[model samples]
Target: MLHLQHDRDFYAWANDSAAHLRAGRWAEVDVDQVAEELEDMGKQQKHALAGHLKILMLHLLKWRYQPALRGVSWRLSIDNARDEIAELLEDSPSLATKLPEIAARRYPAARSRASLETGLALETFPVECPFTREQLVDQDFLPDESASGQA
Candidate 1:
């Protein structure tokens, strides 16, 4: 019956599961489903972190490679991504350990996205990620305009 509720109405299942756990009604709790949901929630956080990193890196790529086009919109986008990344890390400090890997894995996509958005050749971006993990979340770390396509 609880399994049915899980499939039919996830909101009810989640609330009921919490109630069961809180009330010491362990037998009524769908432990497996709860565990799956918890894992998925963690994955969602990681995915969000990856997404913000992509946005940050993309704008930085555009800022560096197409300095002529830089504007407040790009700066705001970078600042917002950094704020989001900082919040996510603060909420789950353990995720900080995975930042380098996530940044590396997400950079190629970000680079390609920057190229597509900026109308630059994909090769205009570096084969490797240019910013350090520290620089990525640093609010003041915009790449030098002179660095340009030398990436």
Candidate 2:
């Protein structure tokens, strides 16, 4: 039970980190490097890291392409990411562990939309780059209180 809660908390934290990054909090950071780091993590670590990456990428898309939603603010993005990741984690047991690969496969489609928004001839979304588990965890950017009970 404790482990389960920890997993949940970790997932939530990851989602929030992603949201922060999307909101330009971590501007200039490379998402792909983050993703690669996540890919190298162990299963448990990967789960948590993936949660963060998904939130970040999702919010990035929302920010770049969905102007109406951008007015909603970063806090809302964090909250929404938390809720969305929670549901996704609950529904798909292996989602966290498999997120990097899943994301890689989805990158092309996501990039196309991003290109339209940036008006750049880039093949991928610069801000939507992947991140590693070590980078996410080591950053210690999220609220520690949120992971307290779970950890």
Candidate 3:
């Protein structure tokens, strides 16, 4: 009939958990809930990282495959994604090791999005991600019309 604080009010439960931890009330703390929350937090970080990577990859695809459409807006989008990804990595350095896997996993969606946005054939893009971790984060690493763009 009655739900627990965690199920009824997440915010209240979180605050209560914090208070319990602060007061060293080990018995009052919900260890299982806290562990689940922590695991969820890590998942959220990974999702954020994948999202940024997808945006960066989609824009890079547009820039490379449709050079004429390239302009300031795309550049800014790419830069902003890179900056956000960098900040995420800085806050959770352990996530840096997961970049390659995340990129690979997110690439197909990025490619499909690029194709839809640009009206380009999905086949036009590579099946696998073309950019490397170094290039993805480099502020000046815009792929050129003729080749991979660089500063």
Candidate 4:
């Protein structure tokens, strides 16, 4: 559980770091070391961390690629991407907290899927359980206004 929270904090820091980097606020950007530390926390931690990292990386890629190519308004793109990332994070509460009972009851299949989806990169940790949209909804893990449409 502590590991899970730590990974979530790492993700939040990485998101802030990426935002700072994008805004040219270099002094505020400081997530590389934190990311490394999160990785070093082991498999479970990596699993939780990777999902959040992947979303952040995806936004970074979008910010980098789109601006270089189409010149498609970077600010708007980033805003949209931020919303999407927030949605993804909200949808996966297990990545934020340890809910063993929820994991046992509602997320067994999702956990299995997350395991296969994350593969070798995050498999080394004991915290690599994957979750599904159905489980997320069933357990009401996400906020009322989350992407799951329950709100």
For candidate 1, list the clashing residue pairs, or say none.
Answer: none
Please list the residue runs of candidate 2 whose C-alpha ends up more than 4 Å from where it truly belongs after superposition.
1-58, 61-82, 123-128, 133-151
lDDT of 4 by residue, 1-151 (tens): 3345446786776676667778998766555665666567545543554443333323333332233442345344434534553454476544444333423442334334434544423332223323333433232232211122112
TM-score quality measure for candidate 4: 0.20
User: lDDT by residue for model 3 over 51-150, one digit each (tens)?
Assistant: 9999999999999999988899999999999999999999999999999999999999999999999999999888988898898988888887666333
- TM-score, one value per model: 0.95, 0.37, 0.93, 0.20
- In TM-score terms, which candidate is top? 1
Clashing pairs in 4: 43-125, 44-125, 44-127, 110-130, 110-131, 111-130
Best of the two (2, 4) by TM-score: 2
Q: Give residue 62's error in model 4 in angstroms.
A: 8.5
Query: How many collisions per candidate?
Result: 0, 14, 2, 6
lDDT of each: 0.92, 0.50, 0.91, 0.42
**Tens digit per residue, CA lDDT, model 2, 52-151:** 5555544555454444445556446556655555566566556656655755655555556556655656543443444343222222333321222112
Q: Could you give candidate 1's per-residue lDDT for residues 1-151 as a string of tens digits?
A: 9999999999989999999999999999989889999999999999999999999999999999888999999999999999999999999999999999999999999999998999989998988898888888788999996774322
Model 2, C-alpha of 36: deviation from truth (Å)? 34
Superposed Cα deviation of residue 83, candidate 4 (Å): 0.7
After superposing all C-alphas onto the true structure, candidate 3 shows an RMSD in angstroms of: 2.5
lDDT of 1 at 19: 95
Better of 1 and 3 by lDDT: 1
